[model samples]
Target: MKQDLVVDSDEALNRKMYLVNNALDEIGFTWCHAKLFMLAGFGYSVDSQLDAIQSSVKVVVDRQFGIDFPVATQIFYVGLLVGAAFWGFSADIIGRKLAFNLSLLLAAVFRPYYWWNELVSHLLAFGAGGNIATDVTIFLEFSPAKYTWLTTFMAAFWGVGQTVAVLVAWAFVPSHLCLAGTPCPSSENRGWRYCWYTNSGIVLGLALLRLFWFDMNESPKFLVSNGRDAEAVATLHAIANKHERLCSLTLEELLDCGEVKDAHDFKTNGYTVKSVFSAAVAHVKVLFCSKKIAYLSTLIFLSWTLIGLCYSTFFNFVYIYIQLHGGNTSGSTYITYRNTSISQFVGIFGPVLAAYMVTFKRLGRRGTMAIGAIITMGILFGYTTVRTQLQDAVFASLTYFFINIYFACLCAYTPEVFPAIARATGGALGVLFSRVGGIFTPLIYYYGLKSGSSVPIWVCGAVIGFLGFIALLLPFEPTRFRSV
Candidate 1:
């Protein structure tokens, strides 16, 4: 673990490892671009259901099935809750790239159920949640220290997804919406179906690109943590070779320390149920082993939970709420969809702004995240007070713009705080808690709507603001603590 210990034995090998580290950074910059392509596609796929709703896919489902639309959104979150935890554990055990590819493929396979049963279609939502856990973990692992900030930038593609969905709806849904309270003739209700088909095509293409186009190596940090020093060294050298560079790193150099050998010997035993449980327990211990990490992890869990509540409740039902509250002035369904598009377009700047703000000497990561959260809370409260369609559109747009920034920072910050060995575990747990909140959001939204249209908005605002204050209590600033 100490560079000096290795240097005393063979100065030349130490220098070679240093050069290998540099080469890894160069390769990361190139690989980071490829990962972005995949992340962008994955982002697009993850939001497909929302795109469907904004595009009047909900109208088709509501008209045909006679089911309340909110119930359908809640079912999707049910799948999401299962998938997020399952894939998070899978990525840590099966390896990131394999888990990464499988999540998208699974989602694509489940997408066609849009035709037969509304409940079955949410199976795609389950896969999409899995994709989120894997995509963020994979991107974080591959990014070099100097450019780790790129993780937040990758979230901008999420906005791209939202925009693409809206554009597709604009092109197809305006002319094709089934009239409300009537049987939606399947043959004529082609707009939402077309959107699903296009979304599936994009996901399928992304899966192939990840499998065939990108020759990504296993994470060297992961290998080192797992006591696979030989593979770690080889991976580093392979990265150098792929980038047309040279590295003098050898397996012996990597294994020079006796500590690593002792660790490797301890890990060589065959797998067992007890061992699996022990490993899970050990990861939990590591996450909260220190007071600083305990505070950080606990607050992050709460923040993610609140985010889930806000994201599911607002995003799934905002368009409908606007229609109900301001329908007289909300214009046609097309204009409401257009308003969604315009908001997403404005949201494109959220991550870009966060990318810069996170680097500021004064603001850094936590400061920026705190500021974004506070602003978002204010916007959420303001959103409840809008009287006209124009006011609703403007406030809602600002709410998302700032919330996206907070979300980006949270994604970027979560993995950075954990060590390489437990990064996936920590992230997955956060998603698990978040999804638990998501699982309840629809029920809350349903009952809140019964109570009053503004009830959910007020509750979401108060909770978001309270959670933001809690996050401010996180003991360590990951940017300052790790520099990654």
Candidate 2:
């Protein structure tokens, strides 16, 4: 997926991408957009909930398994990093469809093992990484340029996901939790398993909906880049048909512009294993083919890493921190989880507000992101002043609210920044770096605990605050139409 229009030259590829972009802009928002939004956004929902379960249930699992160290999240990040690199590279080589549906399906099917078993979390993390990596790209490929802002709203599902996770934990965990300092069998206190089971069924249902009911075609951009103009046009027309609208793009017009890259030309070229590896390398090259793109990609990679660290530090260990601070004494386990649910619920507004914030002539995506990050950092610093559980909940809620604004904007901005062909590859790398930072989060927490419990929050908050200034350095302001 190096160049568009199956063209031999980058110039021709850009021209054809422009044409395809025009045709899609004419389609505007439609039923296909709506359907893809939900399915793709469901990917976000599942990802957050997956993370939620990991954090919320870790203490319970620790007591049950007699684990002294919290390594589940660290192992999960390793799987996430590997998955991002592997599936992301393949998404461009094959298509987004396989990675999209396959990730969730793997999560659902791979859930039979014990929760503490590293294999279970790793497999699920791999699926989560792959799907979250491409879900935005698929949605962006379908969306008309005019509706790009709507992409900001998709992150709202993240709030929904964490909320669901918190509620699930609330319902079963409080009553069945193993006592501290006691190693118990799963039979005595495994309410976390019920939470996992419920979420697995939910993930499975969404996977089925996407795999069978939804006609999730390959990305039109991916198809066009691979020299499959006819298929691209057919996919476009199919969407038009679903919307009962007319599309004027034809294979002849597309091909008339220029020849396309014959990516699937297995007859002429056997598409050896070398081709797959080459495809990955080629996509990475395309992502940084220009000085402008190189600088942008570099900063973005750093941004992802920074955000990943901040998110993992706060969310992954917040529950444990709260528990140690007399979370039960603060108001009982029910209150702790109820506060979590409330925080996540309010966090939903973050993305919704971001949707409107991006449309402002001044804030745009970058400004909104910076503002969100800086504000969240302030909340983090102020959180140390909280001497009560109510203050902790309030600070936690504010943290989610502001950081989500940054997160939603980041998700929307990444796909638009990368070229159509390298979109998935670029995104996967971004997610990979984030997971890289996440892998270190446990060590950060461990050392912070050695010095003082509050030190991790200070470090994470400052890094994110610094990330805000970095956001301002990004020169690209995506246009209302296809800028890539």
Candidate 3:
């Protein structure tokens, strides 16, 4: 009888696993495509607004908003923080598919609203908040075991979107689009508006596609934990069909593994805020209780924060510095902006390299991260001493390269370190901390420039590099560990 029971359990586990894989594969495509569209909106709209405000034509309006820029950025950052906190918990309670669909819907609706006058900032905050929360969680959950390296590639799609935006802006809203006074030119008129409209259209279309075509399903692992053996088996069978792969287990094997019982009991009659909080508490405890996990989380969090601060600070002020040192002639400004955009495009290469290294070569997360950090420090240190335009360009390019590499490694490493229950929450918190670093970066850059010193960049680089070094000591190397 015991042997029979074990065989039945094994079969059940296989069926459930197959179903979960199928659900993840289908939803993953939708999630990635939608994210690409949403990121396009953010890239075009936010960058264009910043550009417009910097131009003389909109000086008065810009001043009003400039005074409010810090506040607006903060609002956006806080919104992301809230989204992370809310959605991370929501994924565990309400179900991943539901939270996933809702987030896309929220982003689709609000992303385009940013095109409306004076509403852009508010809409951006809302859309981005939802986008980050849902997308990050879903990506982590759906990823396959061996192909975990792909997670960062999915997230790096944001950089691709940003690059596309730069190309579009250059084509449509070229430097000649605006001029001081004289009512500006026709081409420049409402160029920013067009950018926002396009972004909105893309998001709206993706939202529609997801709403009509995507099916809702719970994660099989989640189901097993909830003691829904039959449902888990059904879901697993569906997955095997979707993937066209034969599963190895039988129901008896699954039951033998003891996945039939509820992992834990809930006191609440229904899902509530209190219930979410209790789950979050349990999740957090699991993450911290493991020394290896705690160290990994800390390292990832600090590294992301530093990367966010350095990259944002550098890009935000690059144009200003160029014009100051190279003169504000139309040709010079065009060249400067073009160069800055190219730098961003080039930055993509770093992550790509890091991805290849981690995935193909198996440098392991910690090793890759450490190498990236060292390279990043070297680049930043070189940047501070460079005075010539050519040198600036070289240093900037290298700085971005290392930063991207670091980000790629961290993106893959963070999700793998935490338990599934807290994975999204931990990822969100890391991003939130990074945004905090980003918020202060501009202020530091502004002051640094005003003071006529390179101290700020040097300080930022040193801090980040040191943190990366510290991250090297973290335990729980994901490559050797089993899934939580």
**Candidate No. with top TM-score:** 2
Ranking by TM-score: 2, 1, 3
TM-score of each: 0.86, 0.93, 0.77
Best by lDDT: 2
Name the 10 consecutive residues with the lowest summed lDDT in model 1: 1-10
For model 3, residues 1-484, the per-residue Cα lDDT tens digits are: 0001011123444344444444444434445334433432232233223322222122223332234344444444454555555655566656556655565445443222222433444444444443443454455554545555555454455455455555545544443355445454333454544544555555556556556655545555555544555665676566556656454444555565554321332422566667667766765565565555566666767776777677667655544554555433235435645655676577767766776777644466677777878788777766655556566667777877777677766766676665554555666667667767776754765565666555565676787688577657766466554233
Comparing 2 with 3 on TM-score, the higher-scoring candidate is: 2
Which lDDT tens digits does candidate 2 get at residues 267-328? Answer: 24656887777777888887777777788889999999999988988765554455555543
Model 1, 1-484: lDDT tens digits are: 1121120122333343343445456565665456554553464345443434433466565565566636666666667777777777656655666667677776664233343444555666666776655676666655555666777776777777777777777777778767776667767677776776776776677777777777767766556555677777887777667666656656766566433211221246755777665665665666786666677778888888888888777765554465566544357778878887888788878988998888775776777788888888788877765667687678867987888888888877777776655667777888878888887866766665555577677677777677667657766565543321
Q: How much is the lDDT of residue 263 in candidate 2?
A: 48
Against the reference, the lDDT scores of all candidates come to 0.65, 0.80, 0.54
